[model samples]
Target: MEEILGILTQLGLTEYESKAYISLVSLINAKADEISKNSGVPRSKIYPVLENLEKKDLIKIKQGRPLEYHVIAPEISLKNYEENIIHNIHILQQKLTRIYEEKLPHVNTPIITVEGLDKILKKEYEIIKQTKKILYLRIGFILPSEIENIKKALNKLINNGIKIRILAVEECEIDGKVVSIRDIFEDMDVEIKYKQLPSAQLIIRDYKEMFLVFAENSGMSISNSNMVGLFNTYSVIISNYLSAFNKQWSKL
Candidate 1:
């Protein structure tokens, strides 16, 4: 009984509606006073609530001196809910089209140069966490030990179903998930094609939003985020660079 009531609520039936319907189902063709008592709702509220249930098409009202309510079966009530969901989605589509037609671009470039050591790390960590597909990492100048947390983020991305490709300089050690990395590159799931650049560090998402971090030697970055600045929507250029990079690297 509780399970059925729970499912009814999950399907968007109000508390009063589910109780009112359930009470009518057991009593079968009940008037307001009887339904109010069985449903634990007060007499004054039962009639108006029943009106709502009828409007939802979950109940039928037969008028007499006092109106009697009948509960529609689950199959019929659920069909109403399914139709309601579709109708709501169609309405949302229309609303979205109107907003898109009216929306305008902002005047300023949406870029920020973050400062401070911990805040920098936190920001970079956050952005990496939000990545959905593709983390192209190439850290030739920095030793594996220097980029531990960043690599951890990369590993986390790969495990969470984000396709990853690492273009390591042939000499660099495999710092994270070597087997899964090989699995992705060997098949089309993640094509990791690398060319040896002297020292070009890059991390990108969807080949569209990219970050090119310069290897700053001899200074421990006080803030991780402060060290890196993002350049957005340069994927065409990045792709062309990756193409040239891959073409040269694949020669081996």
Candidate 2:
């Protein structure tokens, strides 16, 4: 059946090998020609397919005048397949997790100043995307045009089971419409606290990296020339900001 063939392929069998094995299973024991005829595989391909099945431990050859192929029981073969798969997955997980946790070489300067509003927003999105476990945000007034972008990024992390905590300014005016920053993200899985914040925003990712945005003027849109950003992967600076953020967060 088509479904059985699909399942066999998923278990690491080639299509021809699966067909040949199924035919041999039905016959209990068969010659290559008989397997080819029963499985609708070309005669030229059947011998190689049966040999591959034998190598995979799904079939065995019964020595005879004309060598016969015998199918291994599905229960036994599949149990061995499942155990191999689990062992491989465990090995991969251990190796990849070590690589993921390894620290990178430090640069000449740990802190880098980023200019332009658009570039700062791009860095924020990039940092958040790299977050593996948790994120912390102390948000200032953001332009309406960019709020959706931030929300979408955070939503993706939430869906991935990343823990996110936010501290947002009470409200901001967007094109003559007053919007509550908390209300915008309330539908998401993140926890948010409200307070009036200054014209700077702070974001920390997994306590490994930090991004800070500062606007020179109050009550002005952050998309203006006065916006500047500071970014760093320095552990000490990240810890300090995280402490301050937690202190402020507890008050709200």
Candidate 3:
């Protein structure tokens, strides 16, 4: 019962509404007073909750001296809810993507410098989330501690139908230990190529935005090294960087 209520809330129902709906489903057709008693919802709130459930198409109302509500079959209710949710998601994604693209050229500064490994990783995740179609990444090294989190995000993007291509070193020293970059990410549903690269990392998103991170020392541990990153959405800059990335990709 608790699990069903939890699932209902996750699908965008309030606690009161979920409880009332569940109670009504059990009763099949019940008056507001009966629903309030069975659902533990206060009598004062039960009518409003039921009205909301009716508005959501989850329940039907029978008009009379005392209003009675009937639950929509679970299969039909859930299918309708799922379709509505998916339609809303696509509408929201399209709206947000348009706004993001429109604002790119108007950014006051094309490039912003970021400092620290944690901040760089956070920026990387943020940029990846904004990618609409494809993500291209090349990294000479990754911090040993954060690789798992990166892989998880990449896997999610792949599952969302984002095409991802990664270029990484075969092995690199991180925190004084040799780490195999290929073994960590190659198993995921992404195209990856391994090569020895300079002490830098690059990410291109949808061929429109670019992020580059540089290490102060190639020999130093990446986690402890001084890291600086530059992010921009300038089309010309992205184009130049992509050309270089494709050149390296061909060699691998």
Candidate 4:
């Protein structure tokens, strides 16, 4: 059947090889000419297809006046193929991991300047999504429109077993219902503290990377304001900011 042939091809058999195998499975021990007639493969191609199948251990060749091809049991043949694939994947993982570890110490400091509120928020969302161990955030304020997205990102991080620590200036309310950002993370077991609004906005992840945004006019709506920020993994700068954040957190 076409479907069986398709499945056989997906399992690493060439189309001609799959057809020839299927034909030989039905015929048991058949000469190349008979296999070519049943499988619809050209007689010239059937010999090469059988040879390849024999090489792959999917078929056995019988010595006789005219050579005959017989299909190997699918269970044995397919299981061997699957095991080979998994073994190769494991070997690839080991080699790639070694290369990754070798280059990690030589990695350079990367400082990227992202402009515009939208661009900064986009980068923030990306960084938050990649959070692993810990996320430290100082929120002066977030736009009402962006709150939902930010909450979603935080929730995803929490689900991934990343611990979160947040410091904020004040609470926000929508439609007369108080929206406590901390309350959203209540069951997630994150630490939330309140403080007088800091002059700059900060987001640090895993104590290794940071983003700092400074606005020209503090009173202007954050969504519409022009903001400048650096997103970087410069270790010394990150360490200093982490220390400052810890100092500020201690006060709260």
Candidate 5:
């Protein structure tokens, strides 16, 4: 029953409301006091929980001697909740679009210089997080040691429905987590491209934005002076890079 409440919560039920509803189900018709006793919620809190459920049409409060509450069937309540959530999401999205239109600036160029490896990698994580379109990555030094953080970033990107294209550097052999990532990307809608590259840790987000990172040494250096630049524009140099990537993509 506890696990069932959790499932209901996942479907967008408030914890108290779900418990209240489930408690109501165990009775032919229940009052708030009975619901509180059965559900282990205090009587004081159960009334509000019942009221919320009643407002959603999940329960009917019969104004009888004791005022009994009856739960509507699961199908009805679930559908009602689903539709409510969908409607709420649409309304929220409309507000978000208006906010974005007002707040976001139109940019002229994409150019930034990154100094330290840490800063550059942090920038990489940010771009991945903010991606709303596509992400094309040509990774030559995707070391196994750094796989976890990279995977975490990519997972967040993929979850947001971003289109992902990845070209693994042939020299950067990997296993375990890397292989798991490959399998995930291949299976999901994310596109995977493999290549043998010499250098250049390249990330292109939505084609219009690009960044280049090259390691100064074996590990991502801790040099505070090292910086990674985020550009709102791409360069002609990126055209050459894309052209080569396309050629390599043809082989696979």
Candidate 6:
């Protein structure tokens, strides 16, 4: 059947080999001429196909007055093919991972700037998702609209074994309306401290990358009020930010 031949082809059998094997399975101990006739493969091609199948252990040959070909049991042939595919994939994985690691250091770090509340929030979420070890936040205040989304992203990082430290201004409140930082993250296992209300907003990940927001009342409203942020991965710049954060943290 065409469908059976297609499945065999997908399993790494040549079309002629699949046809010859199918024909031989139907006619046990079929000779080359009979297999070609039944399978519609050329007589000249059928011999080579049979030889290839024998080499793959997919068929057995009987040598008498004329050679005959018999199909291997489907269960045995299919299981062998599956095992070989898995083995090859395992080898490729190790080789490819090594190549990726060797090339990773030469890759350039990206610097991006995002504006508006929605875009900034989305970029922040992406950075948090990529954090492998630690997430550091210094906020002047929290916006009511963005709190839920921020909480979800930070919770996901925390669940993935990332440590989180949040430093907020002394009067840090949600939208300057209600709910303090302590109230929002009370149930979460993150370090929270109050500083002398920093004018800048920062989010650092792994001490390698950071996002700095500079806009008046940046985290208060969802309005597109020139709330600009710079995303950088330069190691020295991030290290300087880390140093400042540590100094601010110690004084709190």
Instruction: Specify the highest-lDDT model's number.
Output: 3
Off by over 4 Å in 2: 1-101, 105-109, 174-177, 219-223
In order of lDDT, best first, we have: 3, 2, 6, 4, 5, 1
For candidate 4, the 10 contiguous residues with the lowest summed lDDT are 215-224
The residue pairs that clash in candidate 1, if any, are 116-223, 117-222, 117-223, 120-225, 121-225
The residue-by-residue lDDT of candidate 4 on 1-252, one tens digit each, is 999999989877889988898898898778899999998999878888999989988789999879977777878987887898789889997899678545633565678898987898898887787666899998765556667798888888877878998888665433334445555545556788887664457898876678887755334333336777888776778889888888999987
Candidate 5 residue-wise lDDT, 90-157, digit = tens = 99988996685344344345466776656777777877765677888887655444567877787777
Error (Å) of candidate 5 at residue 165 is 0.7
Q: For each candidate, what TM-score against the reference?
A: 0.46, 0.57, 0.61, 0.54, 0.47, 0.55
After TM-score superposition, what is the CA distance of residue 229 in candidate 2 from its true location, in Å?
A: 0.8
Query: Candidate 3: where is the Cα deviation over 4 Å?
Result: 1-94, 103-108, 218-220
User: Cα deviation in Å at residue 220, candidate 4?
Assistant: 5.8
CA-only RMSD, every prediction: 9.0, 8.2, 5.8, 7.1, 9.0, 7.7
TM-score, predicted candidate 3 vs. hidden true structure: 0.61
Comparing 1 and 4 by TM-score, which wins? 4
In the range 1-252, model 3's lDDT, one tens digit per residue, is 999999999999999999999998899999999999999999988888999999999999999989878999989987998999999999998999799787875664548999997899899888888887899999888877678788888888988999999898888887678888878986888899888898788999887778899876546555555889999877878888899889988987
Compared with the true structure, what per-residue lDDT tens digits does model 6 show for residues 1-252?
Answer: 999999989878889988888888888778899989999999879888999989888789988879967788868986887898899989997899678545634554787888888888788887787677899999876666778988999889888878999888645533345546667778988998976664557999876678997656545432235678898877777888899889988887
- After superposition, the stretches of candidate 1 with alpha carbons farther than 4 Å from their true spots are 1-11, 86-177, 180-182, 189-192, 195-252
Identify the superior model by TM-score, candidate 2 or candidate 4: 2
What is the C-alpha lDDT profile of model 2 across 199-230, one tens digit per residue? 67898988877889887653544434567889
TM-score of 4: 0.54
